[model samples]
Target chain A: MIVGERKPLEEIIESLEGAEKVLVAGCGTCVAICMAGGEKEVGMLASELKMAAKLRDMKIEVSEATAQRQCDKEYLDTLKDDVKGKDVVISMACGIGVQYMALNYEPMRVVPAVNTDFLGANLDVGEWAEYCQSCGDCVLADTGGVCPIARCSKSLLNGPCGGSADGKCEIDPETECAWQLIYDRMKALGRLEKLTEIRPPRSWKTSRDGGPRRLVREDQKA
Target chain B: MKSGSNLEKVFEKGEFALTGECGPPRGADLEVVKEKAKHLVGYVDAVNVTDNQTSIVRMSSIGASKVLIDMGLEPVMQMVCRDRNRIAMQSDIFGAYALGIRNMLCLSGDHQIFGNQQDAKNVFDIDSIQLINVVHTMREEGKILGGDDIDGKPEMFIGAAANPFGDPFDFRPIRLAKKVAAGVDFIQTQCIYNMPKFREYMKRVVDMGLHEKCHIMAGITPLKSLPMAKYMAKKVSGIDVPQEILDRMKGVEKKKRAAEGIKLAIEQIQEVKDIEGVDGVHLMAIEWEKKVPEIVEGAGLHPRPQVS
Candidate 1:
């Protein structure tokens, strides 16, 4: 689950000021669970946009439609027909959804309705927070479930730095020290001695540094 | 001689007025809104354009009001603070007033979590009370939201929604009093089906002496079908159609339910109007505008006084 927040309505309306036929598109996957981009949200944005347009004395035609998963081509193909006639497509999906629509519908102007923040899960209903950076590395097995890449201000792989203050990080007093959490978890597992092992420098080239990444499954392909 | 101030005169005089509600189109089709406008213009004193009613996005209330204005109808543009903060909402008030929309209905709007676009963020810069106060601030204090003085202020006839049918009934009058205290000139309540409950609620307002301060309009929407009645009873918050009304609607065939709804609505209007406390009635036909005149006439309300 990825957690994110919505942008202000005025900012979004400003983007679509010149557009007459606006399509408020949404995604029903992660964004739906997070209460960000879903059918209900798309309908609301469409209505708000219409209200704003009315005040401006401009005739804005707002249409609402939601896809299953905006990051997938199959889901985006569903909107192939509607996308052509729209002057602007306000995507309420995550950044992936917004870019996916752009990749497929090259002609239509795609705008992000939600500011995609991080890959995290809901703390509870109507609340969400970041948890993962998707660095393409799985060190959770060595460090308990906490991801230092996201929890630690500095993505230190081996152990906590000198800045750990009373089990909390110095930069963010509100955040628990990721190293402290890791050390506690390792101690519980009788692996506290693992901290003494020095770690090699990180190789970030395997992640987004390489460029857009892909995963191929020859067995699943037709 | 000025029409705008002349319109204000009637409202300030405590005269009874009629208002109707219209939801804008979901798509860019103007014809659909125009068709609804056809049934509203000239029949009612003004039409209330919903701003994202039920938190579902559709065409803008402002655009729909313009269409209503083009059709020679006065419009009360509904403004909800759900999507906008203080800056935008204040600016919109001035902008709408400048564009000739003089009436407004302030609301906190539905939470975004309930709408079709669930991922949409919410900016609750202010609640309904603050919004009403802002309008009053502009009208009385003659200043912008930022406290900058203006030579002239925006004069808006503001209204708010009341829920008589909501449970823990004690809170209703208190909420109404709060809105009144915030400078709300009038109030349009949620749907009123059970006159006894509404009458009982009004007694509280009378006890508080609020009846003399604000013009109260009873909201009435005819139950088009048994399913619609059931839906309203179960799904729609702040609305409760009595079992008797549902039973009355249940016996009717589906084809004739619309006519039955109009008759039932007329009956409601007749009951609510005869009550001494209710100043007027706000009819929310809900995509049934054509039946408004029928309901109005059925209730024996003439557009103007008859010659002796």
Candidate 2:
């Protein structure tokens, strides 16, 4: 799921500088799962901003709201009353959510209260590691179901670079080396030959290098 | 000669080829490059021009290679995936090949935080192996990696870096085999201060018979002083310096330690030269370019073949 963390209290407070009314909106989907900019986070941010405003002796009204998913226009449109005439609307969701709020409600400044990180899985409590690069092209089958694009520090397709040490990336020992995991996974599956297969250069068309991508589904568009 | 470059010719004739490294100046100072080239000429078969080594911004490797080419020295331009994307890298490879540069050493560049610039974005679009395959595919098939044909391609002898002492030690030779499968013609390993470990690595290479497929040049850096040895042992990753080596350096007097370091390096050069799978030695006399002639001559690798 999309991962993100809330912006610092100081930065959120500063963005609402001289603001009379502020709306803090959260998403109940991906961001919530990652424990980032979810409904609870929205309330925490709103309360912290209110406390800061009081300490600074500023006149501000902090309100909190949450949508089932902020990336959807329908979910965002339902929050019209909560965001109506608010001096600034702070999104406690991912970047996609912030953009959706701005698209529906214009001229009212929309700011992000969280820094969007990556699409990944939660390994353990308070631990998240990226698992997908959204490279558009997937090589999981050839790589024992591992995503090299997001795991390998260099995005090496063929195999690991010389930096794999103790099954961790040379850049940081804490980060697991993606290729090591791929090799071990392949070995366990008795498909080690899959690792020996040389991979050609990935195409940019399916990657972010191609530019901002948009997908349209004719079958689902009904 | 596959590349028709002097380095490839040396490797082809089965001579213990010697290569040196000449880092381009951080600014536009071609004179510094020429001076370094002067120190390496006649003593080494090729010179590796580092590309923003350690991630600090420097003169582009292609530009530095051009200077070396004009100075009658073969420039092995070192390329890394840290700075450029695929489009930019391919364009630069073609540009370098078009201008008489024929050799390259692909590397996964150091993280930017190690250098002066900590805020720079790292673009590892493809690792060194993928990079080698790109150039190799272009040369063999006369096509881009995406299967598009081009009028010309980089008919260059490609090389990559190896680290035998790095962790998951069992995976080093396997990684080299993968590089060869990706179409690497030659390899220069990370600096070697640990001989037993490197010999063990080469034995594996021989066991896998990778030496028959590609040339492997052992990397040697003559320690300048005891402090330098300590720094390399502690600060540098993937470099294994055994306790005996450090003790040997300590055994020498302060004034004579530099010469002792050189002697140890010459010993390494002589030993690795006999290692069955090892092809040659790459002398990275970093910041000590002037001493290259001495080391090469002392190691009996002087008078690089003048074969055209």
- Candidate with maximal DockQ: 2
Please give me the DockQ of candidate 1 compared with the native complex.
0.02
Q: Which lDDT tens digits does candidate 1 get at residues B87-175?
A: 78887777777777878888767656556877776654456766777887788888866679866578888888887875335545766
Off by over 4 Å in 1: A1-222, B1-14, B304-308
Local accuracy by lDDT, each model: 0.76, 0.87
Candidate 2 docks at the CAPRI level of: medium
| True-structure lDDT of candidate 1 | 0.76
User: For residues A1-222, what per-residue lDDT tens digits would candidate 2 score against the true structure?
Assistant: 888887888788777777799999989998888888888888888888888878988899989999999999889888989998799999988998998888889877999898999988999999888999899988898888898888987787877766666687867878898888888888889997766666766676788888999999999998
Top model by TM-score, which number?
A: 2
Candidate 2 residues lying further than 4 Å off, grouped into runs, are none
Per-residue C-alpha lDDT of model 1 across residues A134-187, encoded as one tens digit per residue: 878667877877787677655656455334545666445576778778877877
List, residue by residue over B19-81, the lDDT tens digit for candidate 2. 999989989988998888898888899999999988888999999999999988999999998
TM-score of chain A of 1: 0.92
Cα lDDT of model 2 overall? 0.87
